[model samples]
Target chain A: MLTVNNLHASVDGKAILRGINLKVNPGEIHAIMGPNGSGKSTLANVLAGRDNYEVTSGEVVFQDQNLLEMEPEIRAREGVFLAFQYPVEIPGVSNLYLLKAAINSVKKHRGEEELDAMTFLKLIKEKAALVEMKQEFLYRSVNEGFSGGEKKRNEILQMALLEPHLSILDETDSGLDIDALKIVAHGVNTLRNESRSMLVVTHYQRLLDYIVPDYVHVLAHGKIIRSGDKSLALELEAKGYGWIEDHASAA
Target chain B: MAGLKIMQVQPDTMLASGTQFYLDQFEQISDKLPGQNVDWLQSSRNNNLARFGKNGFPTQKDEDWRYTPLKPVTGKAFNLKSAPTSGVEHEDTRSQSALRPIPGLNCHRLVFVDGFPEMSMSDIAGLDGKVSVRSLSEVLAEDPETIRDLLDSVVGESSHGFAALNGALHQDGLVVMLEEGAILSMPLEVVYASNQELTLVQPRNLICLGKGAKAQIIERTVSLSDSSCLHNSVTEVILNEGSELDYYLIQDQSRSSYQVCGVWARQKESSRFSCHTVTFGGGLVRNDLRSEMTGPGAHCDMLGVYSLSAKQHVDNHTTMIHGAAHCTSNELYKGVLDQRSRSVFHGRIKVEKDAQKTDARQSNNTLLLSRDAEIDTKPQLEIYADDVKCSHGATIGQLDETSMFYLRSRGIDPDVARSMLTYAFVNDVLGQIKIEPLRDYLEKALGEQLIREKKLFGQTK
Candidate 1:
């Protein structure tokens, strides 16, 4: 579903991602594990077409299209969704209103009919129950003064509403508690299908217990040094990321 | 005759030339002025005209007029029209006024054509004895003493040049008086419309709320003609002890018309006075609103919203004075500028030496939709008492980039996202409107404006 060939990205003339490569097939969930300052978030942001991230070299292809050539919004309409590490607070814009606009925009791009207010409400109500989010949260400003757990749940709600084919969960589990983690994981598991793909980026192995990944890649110093299966998470959690860093440098 | 003498000494400069033209025009029709037999009314006009001679058109050199240049509006000479003798009715006045009526709001209409009140078009039938509505010219002939007292007591000070000019040349206006303890559920609507070219109309409005009385007054200024015209108006509101007054002024003029309006109010002990000024049109518009809290526990609230497009310019200056102890005042002014339009907001809060325990807050915010659009905002707070609490803030910028990106990344089109974010920026002020219908009307109007101006959105520069 997605391919990154020697992805080299920089921000403000500073190299962040250097010669990184990764591939994800359809219906498979891939986990990218790394410590702080490891270019994991940079890769996620670059894939979403953030303006500040300059792709110095390399190319990214998604669903037979050159993803780097598209604008951020065009990438979104084309089924690329990035759940931000820290979601923005847009005061005065109700969540329901934004969700409706998002759903309609993607639908229009796919040549589908637009949903009216009543129909949209029914759809959102069902989706809200999947994440256990209260209906009142949809009427308030988007993430304005929302708790950390509420923000993550709202992100999942948006992902469910848009139904993006390729979703990048950028540190979505960093701020969630045990209960919120279970709910978010359940929401993501429910949306999994044969044609959908996900790249779960996280720093800890606790999240893997909930949303198990088919493959695990440890990113150190902007390069993927090791790739393994779900058991690799438990092994890394037991030995810590320091072991991997030393092994990579010695090699 | 005395006003004519002021014109004789005029120099060839534009400032003097414009002032002399108005003085000469006033001299031509001075003898036929209304309330001619009343000594106080005659003397008041003479004194105001003399004041105009001392204070000519304000220039950019003045501190208050530094950001807003009056040359574009004051350089030309406009002919002042006389009051209509008979009631004049027009189809446009009846139909155009209904285009943006506040649904579910019970309001009385007092239509003015060319500064003269049209009785036939006004709806003053249901008013009881507690309220009195009459044209200024009618009051001058019927009850000259009361008109003289109202003007003498309330309209005493003139802070700017326009107020003096309006005082001297105003032919007629609306006089609304509410008796003590009378509360009118319906809002008094004042609609001013004109269709003349190069015509200047000065309408004066006098509103007096007796002790413990409550009322709402809405003044809407609309020009039906596409020709160049000017509407220089002055409204004086007197709120007695324990009285409450809600005043609203909406200015939506033609492209070529100019509006310079002043609303001066004075509140007595424990009285409440609130004013809302909304400006959406006119080539050049300026509103000077001032409220003085004279007695203890008096409260004053001033709110404004202005949207300027193209080459239109609007300046709003507001002043809140806490003259007594334990008074409170709050002011908020917001503007949205598009194209090369320019806007200015100057808010002044003054707490006197004897006014202790005074609480005052003022904020001015503006959103520049285009690179060329500009806004000049200043908040001046003067607190003489040590125990008073006063704070002011001002901000001017484009939309938040992060918020814009968040909206766009949600699969919304860039243009639609920009407009939606801009709409939310002004929703803070729009949501404060207590009248539901007016709030909805303004919301719809503002939304259409943001959508129609494609260039104003999606471009941070």
Candidate 2:
């Protein structure tokens, strides 16, 4: 469902992602774990199409099309969603209005009839319940004055509404309490389907316990050095990223 | 006589001098004005002409005209085209051109061309037996009871030199009145056209709300002149006791045109007055808004917003005097300056000693998009009473970097993200605009200023 080949990216004069390759099929979840300065978040941002990072040499294919050729809004329309570590706070734009616009943008891309105000209200009510978000949160400006936990949960709620074919979670678990974690995890679980795919990027394995990735790859210096099953997360937890680095160098 | 009158009508101020030709060519039309109408009005114009003959034009030495000097305008005069400007029927705005009616506006509608009314550009279905619509000349011919006595009474007749000159030379404007306790269902919208070639129009409007009456008046002053023209306009409003009035001023003259606009509002006991000024065009624009709350429970809301680019200049000065106890006034003026453009905001709220329990608030917020662009903002509050609640605040800054970074991080290109954040900042003020269509157009226009650059922004993905 997602393929990134020879992804060499940089910012300013320094290189970040160097000669990277990754692929994930349907019903599969991939967790990219790395220590600080490991380009873990950079890979997520690159996939999300942030322009600040220059992709020097790479080709990203999503669903057999040139993903890099599409605009960010078009990528969203094509069922590509990114859950940010820090969501943007749009002061004058209401959360509900922004969500509705996002949904409508994707829907219009799919040639679907736009939802009316009444239908939108009903849809939001059900989704808000999934994330434990009150209706008042929707009425206020997007991400404005929201608590840290609320911001993370709101990101998940957007992911759920978008129902993207390939969703990237960039540290969505950071700053979240255990209950918020569970609620967000529950939302992810509910959204899991046979055709959907996810790339979960994190610095720790705690988030993996909830979403439970099918595969774990240890990324170091912008390249994945090791790959394994769920046990790799636990093993790394028991030890640390330093063991992986030392072991890779010794080999 | 034509050449001499043109020279005599030359503007004596910098703001006026830029378009002094409009006054110069408009010399012939002066005869059409000062009709043999009301004796009081005729004598008043004579008094104004004599007063103007003595003063000539105010200089920097004058107290009120200190910030603005007029020597440049008086140096030379251009011919003011006598014929009404033609071929300016449509505006060249990028957005959709549709006129929508505003419900709940209470008054009769009168449209104007240059300074005179052209019967072709008006919608008069809203006026029936309760109200009447006529040209300024027609008003002189058939004087109504209320309209005759109050024509130039509140305007700067003897005191204000330009106003006196306009009274002596004023051509046409709108006259509206409502019966006591009458509630108007539709607002009266007055459209003034500055379309004639090389035309200069000095327009004036007089509106009176009878006792216990409610009315709304909107002046949409637009000039499509690509050449240099001038539009100097003034309006005076009088609200009787227990009356309510809402006035809206939408100015979109040509970028080469210059305008000096002023409005004076006086409220009686329990009368409510609100004026919303939306200025988006003109080469140089200066507006003076003054209101007096003379009765308890009388309320006033003064709101303004100006968006300009290129060499456009917008200057606004507002004064709200609290004369009676338990009265309230609130003011908010926001501006966006781009390119080498400039904007000035000076607001003053005065609370008298006897005006206790007076609640007043004033705020001025401006955003400078370019380093070369400049805005001067000053919010003034004078409290003679210790028991009044008065507050004033002003802020000038660029867009928030954090918000811009956050948006860009969301996969939005940096430029697109910056534009979004800029829209959000101005929308914080636009959100208060009560009217939907005007708000919608202004919103699109303001946002267009950001992304409508000559070059393309960075492409995403």
Candidate 3:
């Protein structure tokens, strides 16, 4: 469902993602584990078409279309979702309103009739209960004063509502407590199916225990250095990126 | 014809002749318009009229009249004849003065169309106190004693040319005399409408809130013209000792209708005054609101919001005075400008020399939607009291790009995202308005206008 070839991107004349190549099929959950400044989040943001990251040279094909040419919102409509590293606080805008707008935009893009208020309310009621989000939360202005944990849960709820074809969870596990991590992971895992794939980007191996990715790729110096099954996550958790740095210097 | 000219002319204009108009109108009540017995009410009104005739209106040279030239105000000749619904039927009068009255509000509603009341449609249903609303001519035909006195007590004729013209051509207004401890349950609705035939007409309104008396008022002025017309009105609000007054003004006209309105309020010891104005229309609009905290413990809050599009212009000039010790004042004004529209906000707060412990603050903010649109906001604070707290702020900007991008990334159309942010920017002022229906109505109207005029950039491709 997702493929990257020679993905060379830069921001402000500084090269970030250099000659990256990767491929993923449906029903596959991939984890890109990297150290600080290893360009993990940048790869996530670049894939989401963040304008800050200039695609200096690369070819990224998603669902057989020129992924790099579409605008961020268009990419979102075409089923690419990025759970932000830091959820933005938008005051005076209800969380429910934003989620509903997001859902309808994708639905409209797919040539589907928009849901009315009653149906939308029912949709929220059923989806929100799965993550244990309180019904009263819908009345609040979107993420205005939400706690760290609540904001992440709200992000996952949006992920559930939109049901994007490709979900990229960037640093979603950073601010969550044990309970919140489990809830967020449960939300992500429930949405995973044969048609949808997730690229879970995290530094800590604790989250991998919950989400359990099918493949793990160790990213260092803006490029993937190693690819293996889930056992690679545990190996990196024990040995750290130091092993890769030593091996690269030796080679 | 100068504002200062009225200052030297008829200080007792309301005293000597105006009350006589009301006296004859209510001939049975010989001394004053009789209802709730307030002994000194007649004397006060008489003295006020005397001062009004002596002071007259101001000229262009005055500090307040510097930016706004009043040559167009005084030159117009309008007859101050109070004609009730004498010639027309009650249905015709009420239908002609078509203002929807709020339910459960039982206060007296005065109607002034083209400077005269359609007496047939006047509703003074349950008025039974020293407070009675009457047209200047009607009061003259019935009772003139009270009307003669209180005409020009607070705003001297010499300070404003329009006020002097209004005073010189004065005919009607609301008269409230609280006998020490009267509490009114409803707001007094003052409805003034103008017809094209009236040309440049001036309508004057005077409201007196006696000591310990409380009331709320909604003054509405609209033009009945699809062509050009002028509505120059002066409304005086007097809050006596321990009194509280809440006033709201809705100035929604047309691009061809021009208006110059002034609202002056006087607050005595321990009195509180608040004024909320929503301006959404008019070709050129000017609002001058002045409040004086005359006694200790007096406080006043002035708030206003205006949304402009096309070539419409709305200007607000507010003056708040902390005259006595322990007084406080606050002023806030917000505007949203689109297209080639323009807005100006001038807020001035003065703390008198002897008014120690005065706390005053003023702020003005505006949103400019287009590069061609403009907003000039200036907040001024004048302090003579050494021991006082005063602050002022002003800001002008457009929708934030980062916030807009965030909302758009969340799947909200860029236009809808902008609408949300614009609404939030004005929420500060809208939240201050306590009236639920009017607040919601204004918010919705503003939202619709924003969406209609909102130009989303870089979306076509």
Chain A TM-score, structure 1: 0.99
Residue-wise C-alpha lDDT for candidate 2, range B1-461, written one tens digit per residue: 65552322323423444224334433455555635556666676667666666666566686555555344333334233344556535555421132223333443456666676766557667454555545556677776444666776666543455565566666677767677887666767787766654455777777777899877667877764454456766687889999988788888777866777878888888998988888888877878898888888899999887877787888788989999999998898887777778888888889988999999999988877777788877777888988989888988888665565444333344565556666676675567665565567677766675667413322322
Interface RMSDs of the predictions, in order, are 0.9, 4.1, 1.8
Better of 1 and 2 by TM-score: 1
> How high is the TM-score of chain B in model 1?
0.91
The complex in candidate 2 yields a DockQ of 0.27
Q: Which ten residues in a row have the lowest lDDT in candidate 3 chain A?
A: A90-99
- Chain A TM-scores, per candidate, are 0.99, 0.98, 0.98
How do all models score by TM-score?
A: 0.92, 0.81, 0.80
Best TM-score among the predictions, by candidate number: 1
Backbone clashes, candidate 2: 8
Candidate 1 deviant stretches above 4 angstroms: B1-16, B31-39, B83-99, B118-122, B458-461
TM-score ranking, high to low: 1, 2, 3
TM-score of chain B of each: 0.91, 0.84, 0.77
List candidate 2 stretches off by more than 4 Å. Answer: A1-27, A34-39, A49-80, A100-139, A193-195, A218-227, A238-251, B1-28, B50-108, B123-136, B144-149, B153-164, B224-227, B400-423, B435-461
lDDT tens digits by residue: candidate 1, A45-130: 99988878999999899999999998888889999999999999988789999999999999999999999889999999999999
Q: Identify the leading candidate in terms of DockQ.
A: 1
Q: How big is the positional error of residue B120 in model 3, measured in Å on the Cα after superposition?
A: 8.4
